[model samples]
Target: MRRSLRLLAACTIVALVCCGCGTIAVRKTSNVLDYLYPEGSPAIPARDVTLTLPLRVGVAFAPGGTATRRGASDWVNATAMGGEVTEAQKLALLERIAEAFRDRDYIASVDPIPSLYLAPGGSFDNLDQLAQAMGLNVVVLLSYDQAQFNETTNWSITYWTLVGAYVVKGENNQTQTFVDAAVYDIPSRALLFRTAGSDVRGGRSTPVESPEAFRAESAKSFEEAIDDLIRNLADGLKVFGEEATTGRVRGQGTPEIEVKAAPGYSGVAKFENGRYSGALGPVELGLVGLLVVAGLARRRSA
Candidate 1:
C-alpha cells in the first residue's frame, strides 16, 4: 500500500512540473550593458579651476601603446585593418562625441578632427599643438577596442523538461563585443573622463568562420556596444561641464589639473538594485522568468 502511495505521489509531482514546463524557446538576442567603473578616491585639488567655453571639441585617436595595440588586434585579426574602427564608424563616433560637448549650454560649437591625430603617447605638448591647430580648447581623445568571441551551448534533458517535452537539443551560438572610450580637456590637458561597455548577441553564424563571416555576424553587437559607450561618455561629460562651469576655484596660484573619475552607475544609466532602471528587455525577462520558475518548482517539490 505504501509503495502504491509513493508511486502516486511521484506521478502527481511530475504532472505538476510538466504542466508548468512549457516551451522555453530562447531565440537569438542582442543585449548591451554599459558599466562606468567605480572611482578610487577624490583627487587632491591643487587649486580650483573653471571652464568657460565656446568650447570647440574634437575627437581624435590616442597613439598606439602596448595595451592599445594589443586591443586593436581584434580589428586587425578580423578585417585585416590596422585600426579597430572602420573609417565610417570612426567619423560617426567622433561626431557623437562632439555633440555631447555641444549639448552643454556653455559650449557654442563642436567639430571632428578630420585627420587621425595621435597625441604622441598622450603627451600634453603634442596635444597642445594639435588643439591649437584645430582651434579647439577641448580635445576628446577616444581609443576604442572591439572583440568578438563565440561559443556553443547545448541544452540538456533537464533544460528540455522546462522548455517542453518535445524540445530538441541543439547548440546555440553566442558572440560578445566590447568598446572603450576616454575624454580629455586640451587646455588643462587633463584626463577628464573614461568609460567602457560591452554587448552579447546570439548570431546566425559562427564569428570565427572567416573575416567576412565574423564581421557580418558580430556587426550588431559591435554597433550596440559603441552606442552604449558613447551614451555613457556623453553623460559623464555633461556632469563635468556643469561642475567646471559652476564650481568655485580656490587658492589660484596654479590650479592643479585633475581628471575627475567617471560617475559610476550614476545619472540616467541608473543601475539600482542590480538591474538597469530602463525597460527590461527579453534578456532580462528570460533571466527573471527562469528564477521564478525555479522557485515554483522548489516549492511544489517541498
Candidate 2:
C-alpha cells in the first residue's frame, strides 16, 4: 500500500509538469518540424511532353551515418533507425516531393513502399529487384553529409521509476548532428539526380546517459534534424527536381547548372570545364541558417 502511494505521487508530479510544459513543447515542435526537410516532385520538361508518358516517382533510401559518436551529427543516421523517425516528418517530406510531381499531373500516385538501398550482402541487394517491385521508371535516392556538431546536453532531474528512486531528472544531451544529403536514380544504376541542398548541423552537448534523458534527447534530436532536412529537401526538390528529370531524359553530355546564391554562402559547383556543374540556390542556404539557429537555441534552453 505504501509503494502504491509513492507511485501515484510520482505519476501526479509528472502529469502536472507535463501539463504546464507540453503545450509549449508541442508548439515549438510543430513550427520547427516544417524546416526539418524540404522536398518536392520534379517538373517535367515543357518540350518533351509529346514523346513520353508520366513516370512513377519512387524514393529509395540508403543506409545513413553520422560524423562522430558524440551524437553531434545525428542527422546523418536518423532515418535508418526504422521506427525512430516520426510519421509526420517522414511522410511530410515525401508528400511534398510527391506532390510536386503530382502537380505536373503527368505523374501517377507515388508508390507506398519506396525502395531502399542496402549495405553489401543485405537482403535487398539487387537494383533490378527494387525497380521491378516498385514498377518504377524513376527513383530518388537521398544521401546525407554531416552538417552540425556538439554533444553537451542539459538535464532536469525528475522522479525515477524504480521502487525507491524518486524524482528522476531529465537531461538533454547531444551525440551526432551530421548533415548529409543527395539524390540518385535507381534504374540504370545511374546518378540521375543530386543536390548540395541544406547542410546545417546542430551541436548537441553529450547524450544524457539515463533512460529518461536518453528518450527525450533522442526524440528531440530526431525532431530537429528531421525539420532541417525537410526544409532543405523541399528547396532542392523544387529547383533541381524538374531539371534533374529533364537531364535524365535527354541530357547526355556534360552539363552545368547556373545558380544565384542568397548572399554570403560560398556557392560552389561540383563539375568544372563543361562537366557536371550543379547549381544550389538561395532557398536552401536560407533554410539551413534558420534551422541551425533554432537547434542551437533549443539546445541552450534544454
Candidate 3:
C-alpha cells in the first residue's frame, strides 16, 4: 500500500507538469477608423437598408515570407482535420454573423450571398459585382487569419526507478485568430466602416496530439473570439449610423422638415404667414418665451 501511494503521488506531479507546463503570451494589433459617409449621401435609416452576408467566408494569412508560409501550413492542417468545414458548420457561422446584425436592427433584412457568386478565394475585390448580383445595398466583407504554434519540452516517466521508456513527450500549443471586417455601400462603392479583433488561447497536450484535436480546440477558440468581435463591431456601428429608439429614429445628416402652424398653433411654436414664410418671426419668438415661462412656473408650483 505504501509503495502504491508513492507511485500515485509521482503520477499526480507528472500530470500537473504535463497539464500546466508551459508559458504562452499573445498580443493584439488593430486599426479602427470612424464611420464615414460622403457628402450628400442618403441617410441609411436602419430599417430601410438591406445587408448581405456572403456564403463564402474568407481566410487570409499575414503578409511576409515566413508568416505567410506558416499560415498556409496551418490552414492546410486545419482543413485536413475532419476533412474540411462541414455544411452545417458553415451555415452556423453565417447565421451567427447575420444574427449579430439582426439583433441590433442595423439593416432592414439580412440575406446570404450565394456561394456561386463568390470567387474561389473569397476576396472582397468583387464586392461591387456581388452587390449588383444580389441587389444588396450594403455588403459586409469578412476576412480572418489564424496562426498556431506548438513547442515541445523534454520529459520522461520511469517505472519504479528501474528501466523505462523516454519516448513520451509533452507539448504546448498556442493559437491566435485575427478577424477583419469592412462595411460597404454598394451603389456608391463607399467603405462606410472598418474594424478588427483578435483572440489567443493556449493549452498543453500529451502524445503530440492529432490534427483533429487541434481543429476542435481552434474552433472553440474562434467561437469565443467571434462573440466579442461581433459585439465590438456592433458598438462601432452605433457610432457611425443612427439607431432607432422606442418612439423615434436617431440619425445624422437627416433632412429637416419645415413646420407651419396656422392661427390655432398650440404645440411648441406658432407661425405667422408673411414675407418670411419659413422664418420664425415675432409670434414664434413669443411662443418660445411663453413655453419657457410656463415650464418655470410649473416647476416652482411642483
lDDT of 3: 0.47
Which candidate ranks first by lDDT, i.e. highest?
A: 1
Give every collision pair in model 1.
Answer: none
lDDT of each: 0.48, 0.39, 0.47
Model 3, TM vs. native = 0.49
lDDT of 2 by residue, 118-217 (tens): 3322222354565676666555544432222222112221222332122222322233333334443343333443543332222222122233433344
Candidate 1: residue 276 lDDT (0-100): 35
Sequence-dependent TM-score of model 1: 0.50
| Runs in model 3 lying further than 4 Å from the true structure | 1-90, 114-116, 120-125, 156-169, 242-302
TM-score of each: 0.50, 0.41, 0.49
Q: Write out the backbone clash pairs for model 3.
A: none
